[model samples]
Target: MNLKGIHHVSAITANAQKNYDFYTSVMGMRLVKKTVNQDSPSMYHLFYADAQGSPGTDFTFFEIPGAGHTYPGNQSISTTSLRVKDDAALHFWKDRFTEHHVDHDPIVELIGKATLSFRDPEGQRLMLISDEYNQGVEPGIPWSQRTIPAEFGIIGLGPVFLTVADITSTKKVLTEILSFKEISEVDHFKLFETGKGGSGAQVALIEDSEAKRERPGRGSVHHVAFRVADETELEFWKNRIEDSGMPNSGIVDRYYFKSLYFREPNHILFELATDGPGFTADEEFDELGKNLALPPFLEKDRTHIEAQLKPLQSSKE
Candidate 1:
């Protein structure tokens, strides 16, 4: 049961319309799904991904109005990184950000790859890394109406950075349980790789004992999901996690994929999700993200859910 890489990274946003605009128009990703959060039906849960809404390409957000700002500290996902074609793609994004008046940092070299760091409208940290090494790994499906061309468009997710208060226990869960191999270390940052060790396969842990713990709110990563091939693989992880004394949300049918959520030693939320039964399950391939989608369980309350959600404008509009 080998975990592939990231399935998706979910965050929180205070303003649904602003979040929709930045991810769809500015970032050039397709609004793969428009739905409401299962637990909190009044809040919108938006999914943005590649044209096909591939597993590793999803970056989601939950609308949580009036949520507090994220506290900068250890024990949280500090940044979510996306993979771009190469250095040229990074330059293209740089110019795009400048033209749109989006504040971003200059491209810098990290882990021997060109990286461009930036923030969303809500100040959630994001980065783009050159993926020349993993060009053909899984070049994501390009949205037809994308502002950026397919060649220089963003690929799947790249390495995600987690700030941990202590590396000892966290390292144990990552290596022994999750099957991550420690590839390298730079100063206090340790790099771990799963599967093929490029693009979405990497995760970086920054040891920062002196830093404070994080508070969940808008602009904070809610959870980071990792990919499992299918239900069999997901079950393997569920058992492994439970047997190892880790508490998990056992076997949840999330419509698009089955998932099991567990918190690591540092309290960072992690999810093991299946790869299939993708976004196309509830909607047609060409009509995805065109209307409100609800799981069968939530279908009965569709009218109420739609009434609670704010009307969002898509880039296609």
Candidate 2:
């Protein structure tokens, strides 16, 4: 069984309201889900993605009130990349960021792709990578209703960056257990890709042995998930990961898709997720994320869940 590409990247946020504002109003991504974190029903878990909330486009967050600041270091999912249409789109974002006062750097070339690095208000590290010449995994369609033009809109997630203390052990887990192939390495970073290699199916690794381990808080990535075709394949991965002696969360019914989570050698969380029965499973195509949604298991506690969350939208926009 081959892992397709990045499924989603979940992160942390201290304030859900501000997170919603920045992503929807600034980043131009659609809020596809405004539900509570299933594992911890008291706080909100938001999902931002393309028009359909496609598998490869999902960027989610779990709100933790008064979450502390993140101390960036090794053994962390250092940076998350968002894919744009081309190099021109990369510059358009630079100009847009200036208008909105978003913290970002000038465009620079990385492994032949134009890249722009930026940070959110909470100090979340992010990059916008051009997919102009991408020939591997396809990107998702950005939300058409967004203020940003479709041509320059973010299409999907790109290579996830990992900073680890032990490059040898992390490389073994990736190349051997996860089946990633090294495509290139430059300076201090090494690029690995799985399945059909390209910007969409890649992970960039940076070994920083001198840095201390990351103190995760608001703005830190929670985990990165890779795509599996379906539950059958996910089951196969469960056994394979188990055989490799890496402890994993066995098959979990996430309602939208099946999932099993595990951490690689560097203590970075990784999840294997299916691609079917996605965001539209419970909500209508046009009505997604308008109201709070709960899974079948959490339906019984709807009243309590609603009471805990501050209303994401004052009224339907």
Candidate 3:
């Protein structure tokens, strides 16, 4: 079975409140899920996405107070891109970034599309790529209450950029282990595409054999998860990864979706996750991101968990 496009990209945030404000107020994305990290219930794991928290639209973060600044280098998910409607949207964002004092670069053509690179307050490397006439995977609609005009609003995620030491090892895993195909190359960067290839289903590899490994902290991406159709497909992927002799976390119950996490040859974390039983699983659609949501397994520890977390309130709440 073929994998779908990206499911979500999870990064680190030292201050949940500032992260919330920048994404919701400045970037104009909707805060779709307000939950705790299942692995570490004391910290927040916030999810931002399109109107209904669609799979490919998810951009999430895990809070870690006092996290140090990330030192950019190799073997890292260096940059994350958000999908905008067209070239005009890219210009719209440039203007908006100026208005909000958001750090950004002028729009330019990259990998066959117009892109505008920018960074969040915490120095997260981000870009806005236009999906004008995009015909691969479907993009989610903008959130209803977003102050930014719906036409110029951000949609789903675009191509994720990976900076690695050696492209050979990572490329093998991407092609043989996973199903991505090498589509194009520009200097040190090679572009790969998976199911229904487009901006939404691509990853760019930037090779720097001499660079040091990245020091991940605040603003560093923790992992990139690709979308699988369902639990059955996720199980199938687990078997394939195991057969290929790659050590993996097999068939994890993520509450919202089932997942199988594995690290590629370059040590970049990759997760295969299902697309269903989403944020709506524990809360109503309109009520999403409004309250602290705990899965059934974590329900018993809700009191303790609540006590440990600092309040991360937002307008959605």
lDDT of 2 by residue, 260-281 (tens): 9999989999999999889888
Instruction: Give the TM-score of each candidate.
Output: 0.96, 0.97, 0.98
Clashing pairs in model 1, backbone N/Cα/C closer than 3 A: none
User: Tens digits of per-residue lDDT for model 1 on 210-235?
Assistant: 98898878899999999999999998
Q: Candidate 1: misplaced stretches above 4 Å?
A: 135-137
Which 10 consecutive residues of model 3 have the lowest summed lDDT?
308-317
lDDT at position 59, candidate 1: 92
Worst 10 residues of 2 by lDDT: 308-317
lDDT of each: 0.87, 0.90, 0.91
State which candidate, 1 or 3, has the greater TM-score. 3
Higher-lDDT candidate among 1 and 2? Answer: 2
**Model 1, global lDDT:** 0.87
RMSD of each: 1.4, 1.4, 1.4
Candidates 1 and 2 compared by TM-score, better number: 2
* Candidates by TM-score, descending order: 3, 2, 1
